[model samples]
Every structure is written in C-alpha cells, then in structure tokens.
Target chain A: MARLLLLACQATANTVENEQKSMQVAAVDTSKVSTDAFLKNRLEIVRVDKKELPDGLLKVQVTARNVRTGFWTQLASWFMGDNPYQIAYRFTWLDIDGMEVETAASTWIPKTVIPGDTVRLNAVSPNPRCKDFTLSIRENDAARG
Target chain B: MNTKIISLIGITSTALLLTACGPSVKRIDATGNEGLVTVDEVDFKDWQIAAEKGINSLLASGVLNRSDGRKSILMISTVKNSTMQHINTRILTDKIRQALLRSGKVLTTTAVGGNGPDDMASKQVRRLEEDDMFNQSTVQKRGTAIAPDMSFSGEIVQQTSSQGRMRESYFFFHMALTDLATGLAVWEDNVEIAKQGKKPLMGW
Candidate 1:
C-alpha cells in the first residue's frame, strides 16, 4: 500500500511540475519603516549607499554588523564554537506609486555573520521603475531557508 | 511475571515504530525555502537559490541597458554543467530568462543560436513563402529579423571533500555576458552553495 501511494504522489508531482503557484505581494509603506526602523532586524545598521547606475537603475548597498547575542547563542557559538549568527533577508522593491515591484530575486536570501563581523547586503533594482525598497530580516528558520 | 513485562514492552515498542513511520507525501512551494536539504547532490532548493543570485547580479551588471532606445537582444550560448549530477542546464537558465524578461532591459533571441534556435518556428514560419496557397504579402518580409547584441554563457562545477566524520560538497555557478561586437565579457558573476554534515556511526 505504501508503494502504491508513493507512485500516485509521484504521478501528481510530474503533472503539476509545469504549472506555477500564484503568489501575492504587499506594498512597502514608508510610514512603518521610517527613520531607524531597519534596526528592528536585530543587526546593527552601519551604512547605506544609494546611487543611480549608468542604466538609471537604483542600486543600494547596506553595510551592517552583527551585534546581538543571547545566553544560549553565546554558549553555543563562543563557548562551544559551533553556531554562527545566521539570518535571512528579503528586499521589497517598490515603484514611485508605493506599489510592490515583482521580481524573481525578491525572495528571501540567507546569510551567516560571525559575532562583530560586518556584512554587505547589496541590491540593484530589478526594474527601471523601482525607485525605493525596504528590507525584511529574520532568524534563519532552517538550514536551506 | 518477568516474561510478561518483556512481552508488554515489546508490544508497546512495535506499536510506536509503526506509528512513527511518517506521512506518505505532500505538496510544497517549489520556489519557497521549505524544500528539503542534504549534504550530497543538488536539490530543487539549491537550484532556485543558486539561480536567484545569477538573476540579481545580471540585472545589476548594467550590461542589458541599451543606449539606443531599444531592448538588448540576448542569446544563450552555452551553460556547461560539469557537475556530477545528471541535471539539465535549463533549470538554471529558465529562471534567469524569466527574470530578465520581466525587467524589460533585454529580450532573448529565438531565431538563431550556437546549438541552433531554441524555437525553430521563427525559421520555419518563413518557409511559408514557398506555399502558393498563402498570401505572399502576409509573409514576413526578408531582413526583418533582429540579431543578438549579447551572448550569455556560464558553467556550474562541484567539489567534494571529507575530514574525520564530516562531509562537504561545494558548488560554484559562474556566468558571463559577452558583447558580440566587442568580443569582451561585459559582466561576470559567481555564486556558491556549500553543504556539510557529519555521518553517524552506523547507516549508509
């Protein structure tokens, strides 16, 4: 019975492979993420550089340092020297109208930062109309995530 | 009494094992991060995460931005897969292609390529001129086809190593975009994915 069930699932997966799942994206509100709200990600914000590329696309670079540590995290990372400060970040690109700009690269990306280590999160606007962006960060949920 | 207790423990253990067999199967987000991971072999999640880097970097390269008030035409030259896995290269390029199309900076060519056109219909449709049943005026006029302005190519490679009880696998996705007129690589990017795990004392 287990073998029969597995084959049926395999067949369904093959049929669904060519189809895409629908997704919804919400716009980024400047009112919520106004001045200094980026610090809520638990990482210390160091610097932000923004400029218009030769192609007129907006390019932004965020330099941040890992500064937060808990008792368990320190014990696992400092004492045992096993874990590092791992986090995942996603960029929310926005148009001038404050609407979300959809792009394949907008998905969450994972990163690892050792204590006191500085990292740079760089992004180039996927579309010429992308004029603004907001970043969302959270602790790494799983190994691949 | 001792015999009865051992029998009781054996029956309880058997029931627990059967119940812990886990679900048969389920569906998940193909592009999401909920996919499984392993220290060996490239999985769906690996391909998605790896392709995401290529798309982001390519758009950031500024090579696709045309100054002539026209979208740059792109051709997929060769994406070599030197990995040990029996994988198709399109799994990586298709995502990049879809992203670039959405950006509106570049349009991929389908009329010509190194390995022949991806879609033969453009070339085949032109052959309609030979059929007298069709209107000659409606046939696409000669010299209306556009040539590619740039070529996109890359390679994916894998490396493996083992130390003590830990095993590691590293993959590098290297890509480049070349200007056909100048024959110079205008943009290049390399993305890496590393996986490592320690083996248990027993089991394959």
Candidate 2:
C-alpha cells in the first residue's frame, strides 16, 4: 500500500511538471517598431506611397528596411516557436484640415513578418478625415499585460 | 382474542422492518454520481475567460471611441465561424457589444448588417406618434434617424493539433471596426486562446 501511494505521488508530480512546461509561451522577439530603440538605430523608413482610396480618401503605405542585417535577422531567428505571430500598425488620422479623427477607426493591423521579409502596412483615411495621415509601427508582445 | 391480535401486529412490524433492511436500501447509497472527474473539449471556464479577454481587449484598445463628429453608433456586421465545432460566435460578440456599451464608448444598433434584423419594434412604436403628427401636417418632416457611424465585423478560427493523448487546441478571434462612409478599417484586434489536455481513459 505504501509503494502504491509513492507511485501515485510521483505520477502526480510528473503531470504537474508537464502541464507547466506545456503552458509556457514560446519566446518570440517582441521588439515593436515604435518601442525598440536599438533596432530603430539600424532600420530606416525608406519610402512611403500615398494613394486615394475609392472614396477619394488618402492611404499612406510605409515601408521600413533594415540597413544592417545582423541584429534584426538575429532577432527573427529567435522567434522559432511563435505561431500565428502578427505585427500591428497604428495609424493616427487627420481630417482635410489636419485634425485627428479621434475614432476607433484609426488602428490598422498586419501579421507575420518572417526574417529578412519586408513588411507592408496600410493606413486609410476615415472618409472626410483622409486629408493626411501618420503611421506608427509597433511589435506586439504576446499578450503580456 | 387480544393475544392473537397482538401477535399479528408484531409479525407485521417485523416484516416491515425486514423490508426496510433489504439490498435496495444499500443500492441507494451505492449509486453515487457526484464528484466524478471528466474531460471536455471546451469547458465553461474557457468561455468565461475568452469572453472577458475579447471584451477587455476591444474596450482597452479604444476602438469604440473613434467617432467622427457622429455619436458612435455601431452595427454588428458578420462573425464568421471557421471552427470544426458549431460554436455560436454571437454569444462572444454580444458580450463584447454589451461591454462596449457599458463603457459608454459606443452603442450597437440592430438595424444594420448582422446575422439578423435589428429589433426596431420599440423604436417603431415610439415613432408612431411622430409619424401621425407628420401625416396630419402638424410637423413638416420626420426627425432624422441616427445611422450607425461604424460597423463591427470579424471572424473566429480554430485549429486543433494532437499527439496521442496530448492535444492542443487554438482559437483566434479577429475583429475590425470600419467607417461606413469611407469603407476603411480604423481599428482591428486579434486574440489567440489555446488549451491543452490529455485524453481521459476508460471511466473518465
């Protein structure tokens, strides 16, 4: 009977350990474009294109490229087990008169930028507010806070 | 005659006592169903967590407050369920809508595009007097009806991968807030929830 109880205790401990390990989130590089000071040092916003949406509103597409391949590439390599990873871009919109729209309609999102991949983000003008736009890119930390 | 009657009563009492002491009495205690351990694919606590997470994220992101001069009126658009199970995505979205309204950031209208028609019967009833006044030429025109300033639309996708008894199920919730006039998505959020479990053997 004592041996049986000891065996059960061992099994319970093993199960607890496995459960803890399984619940752990695989580490992914959480450096956001707006937050990472180090990456910003090496990467530069190369070109941005502005176009009129079908409603005659303007959309700005900003592309950023890394000047040095070392740090950014190394960070991407660290995100091995992160699945369904997404990169979100926040767009602050201004009216034709250059006033912020101040609505929930300002945030646009993009996902999954692998290593050495050029990421594209779209920022649309909310109707009458599409007179001008500014795009901010941030790397999403996996639901930490 | 008195002795015979007493004996008869005693015999009946003994028989009744024996009947009460039978195996059926033990069967009543033997049939136990409480505290049974079982495994389910989606537990009630999971839904509770998912609902709270979805609503909190949507609210905290300030998606509902983005109104352009207009009072942020929202219409529930479409919630596509891309899961193997026939899960009701509306249950999740409704909780989010209610939370948004409670936050005073936005209000949802039934009339706009959703899974069904908006409940306008109450609005219609209230408008009848105004309609009558307009018909009698007492008023020049009907009051301007408030239209939804934005539309809420999104999808729920689920992926399940398992190795033997160990199973991992992932659910992704994606939502977008779009401006009606420009058809541009202003706010978008995605939430991923995953659960892991080992298969139950035999009784469990």
- Reference interface contacts recovered per candidate: 0.48, 0.00
DockQ of 2: 0.02
Which runs in model 2 stand beyond 4 Å of their true positions?
A1-145, B1-42, B66-70, B120-143
The TM-score of predicted model 1 comes to 0.77
DockQ-derived CAPRI band for the predicted complex in model 1: acceptable
- The TM-score of the first chain in every model comes to 0.63, 0.54
Which residue pairs clash within candidate 1?
A: none
Error of 2 at A76 (Å): 35
Task: For residues B1-204, write the lDDT of model 2, one tens digit per residue.
Answer: 999999999999999999989875223211111122223243333343455545545554554554363448888888888877767776666766665555455777875567665575635554566564455543323445567888888887888888988777887878788888899997787877675667777542
lDDT by residue (A66-135, candidate 2, tens digit) is 4434565556434422222334445665554545665322222434554445655544444434355556
Tens digit of per-residue lDDT, candidate 1, span A85-141: 666666777777667898865565778877668898877888788777776655554
Clashes of each: 0, 6
